[model samples]
Target: MADFNYAFISLVLLLPLALLIFLYLIVRPRSVNIPLKNRHVFITGGSSGIGLALAHQAASEGARVSILARSLKKLEEAKDAVRLSTGIDVAVFAADVRDYDAISKAVDEAGPIDVLVVNQGVFVPQELAEQDMDEVKFMLDVNLLGAFHMIKAALPTMKNRVDRRPASIALMSSQAGQVGVYGYTAYSASKFGLRGLAEALQQEVIGDNIHISLIFPPDTDTPGLVEEEKRRPELTNIIAAGGGRMKAELVAKKALNGIKSGSFIIPCNFEGALLSVATAGLSPQRSFLMAFLEVVTAGIIRIVGLCFQWVWYDSIQKWHAQKKRT
Candidate 1:
């Protein structure tokens, strides 16, 4: 009986391994690929957060980045940060991704974008029972419809212009896109729709060689997160928390790397990858495996952050007490 169990486990592993190897032998990895150097890259929501971090990283890799967002002041700041960090001149375009005309105008000004990163998004936490109509509309308009608008604007250049190499289109998705969260009724709907859109677009433009990459990032820290924490209500804990926020720079790095590699679905971190697997393997109710893992990761990070906060507060308190005593 023990021998039978061992044999069963080995067969389960080896069967999949054998099938994967067979597929690999049939179609080997592509060797010739364009590096980011001197490439014209466009990013939505690039004025802050992960998009800005990516702009900085891409500039370091010798890519000319065009940062797009609604705020002109923020765009200038982003350009300065990228220039200071990488000594690469960054161009800023103030445009709302939700507006197709604005996105098209920005793309035209950028002059044939070789890489397009769709990162514009909005996060609203409302329980399904109490979900406001406006909240749902806002999330969909920004997260799903915004991505659609950008993709449509770029499709012409990506399809007809006949660039020397294939242009890559990257969409910023979330782990919530791949799996369901308790209080993410609107958010999950938009994200899931984004993933579906990217996959369908991948099929539409595969012949044109417009490489499409959908990035599924876990919680990441960004400039906007300060406002996020301040505005967070009770529902925020369930749907809006970063869940062990990774550095923005790291998320940006992964996004570009995934694009260059032609990865269809990019998981941002180890936890994201694990969650992706768990999402595929487990049933909805049995999704506690992924939930538990996220909890454990978040708990560790929170403990560390709280400890630092506590120590700093204590030191300040001690200094005050000593000054008063003296």
Candidate 2:
């Protein structure tokens, strides 16, 4: 009985990954006929993290890739890294996601793109009461406004491409956008907006052969992750209790496959994917509130455990070691 139960759960879990992979395999030649080969793939915030990882993936898949970010040095490094990994030459452009003109310039420089991935974002943790105006504004500008500028400039060419294969757009969002979390008011809002944009764009472009995918990745292990942990306040212990962080490679693979599959909401994490599919079927009002409450509640519980461990466990462990020596 136990074995049967285990198998059932395993199927429940692996079923989704298999299904997504199958979707990608099924759509590879039928929908796009190109498999991203010799295609111009443009990625925002591609200097590092998942964006860079996706650049590497696209390179390996035979795509001529270009990445845009704000740091020239980091962009060079990322280009080198992708070159090392995939033996492909990738172009790096320094452009701020928030600037439409700058993004337009970068796009022109890269030329027509076959696949555009908007993966740039910012996470500002602030409470509504404290209203860290600077952080909140920066988050809105980078996470929301930046996405808008990139999409607006890329849509024209994406829709009217003269290439053999139709173009596709992938927007990188997060589980936080799928649900609300404490101290992530602005971040959540920006992601939710991206979610909305992808949905509307997908609908409006019906029969145009232009695909749009909204990706919701959970907290992933990346360079930005270390910074988040270092800056994390004691209160953030609450959110730290879930599964270990996701990897950039895993999330990037999912994003690429999701785009191929024309998935409406691509969850970057397994748990996130399950929840996304489940909630996407429900009313938006109920789904958002429920998801929000779950994030907040889990965060609080984890933080409480962290506070207790800090208060009592460290000293106890040290004392136990001394007693053992004595």
Candidate 3:
């Protein structure tokens, strides 16, 4: 009797599975592994910190690297350091990312780019009320509009590469980009703009066989972070307390790995992973299994995210109360 209904039962069960498989095949990003070897990898903010570390890694991996920054002296220093470490001479360009003309000239001279990393950013942590308007404008210009200028300048050449191999554009976003935190009003606004930019850019470039990666790195041990710590407000520190700091080399490695894999969202730590899953709204995902995880765990992650928000709010209230007493 059961055997008689086997075909009907199988059809019912397998149809849903088949539909899911079809969706996975179509919706998933065109999977790609962008090869860095013997390819041009152009990095903005390459003079120091995570950008320099990434430049070093790409060079060591046999990539033809070009480093760009506003300061020519720092660019020269980065070139020397990369040469000393990898024995590969990387091209250096001095161009402020804010200036589209300067960026366009640099991209034209660097030749066709196989991978473009927009890693330049600036942050001045202060409550929105107390922060100067100029500081907000500076962060918005450098962190948000600066990336726009670089992408606009580089995209035409990157799309027309003779080799026609897959290319990558990696945006260096912070955890603040994923979620707004205390005293990061202006900074978070600028960084959060990157997520929207990355998501839309992916849709525009997928036809050109280009992939976009948005990297969310927690506080990393870098010269910039050292400087940022001196001005961090007490509330900012409290809000950022638990997320651990990672070394620049590790962050660079993570960023490169994600870039090569055509990953859409690259998270650098445990908290970052949790944050990614929680904020996985409508972002392009190349990995089928990761997409499944994101879909299945959405409800659970929402609960956990709420719990985290509650804790954060509790901290804020307690800190404010303690401050008022003093």
Candidate 2, pairs of clashing residues: 238-299, 238-303
139-218: candidate 3 lDDT, tens digit per residue: 99999999999999999988888888899999999999988999999999999999999988898998899999999999
Off by more than 4 A, model 1: 1-17, 25-34, 233-243, 280-326
Q: CA shift at 225, candidate 1, in angstroms?
A: 2.4
How much lDDT does candidate 2 score?
Answer: 0.74
Looking at model 1, residue 113 earns an lDDT score of 77
Q: Model 1 Cα RMSD, Å?
A: 9.8
TM-score leader: 3
lDDT of 2 by residue, 1-326 (tens): 99999999999989766755554454321333225888899999898899989998988988899999999999999988988877888998998987889999888878888888989887756566876788888988998889889988887777777864667888888877875665678888988888778767766764567777778887787888777777653444354333236889999998888776656567766567545644463212212333444343555655654664575455546656878999
* Stretches of candidate 2 exceeding 4 Å from the true structure: 1-34, 281-326
Question: Which candidate do you rate higher for TM-score, 1 or 3?
Answer: 3
> How many backbone collisions does model 1 have?
0
Mark the regions of model 3 whose C-alpha exceeds 4 Å error after superposition. Answer: 1-23
lDDT value for model 1: 0.74
The TM-score that candidate 1 achieves is: 0.77
* Backbone clashes, each candidate: 0, 2, 0
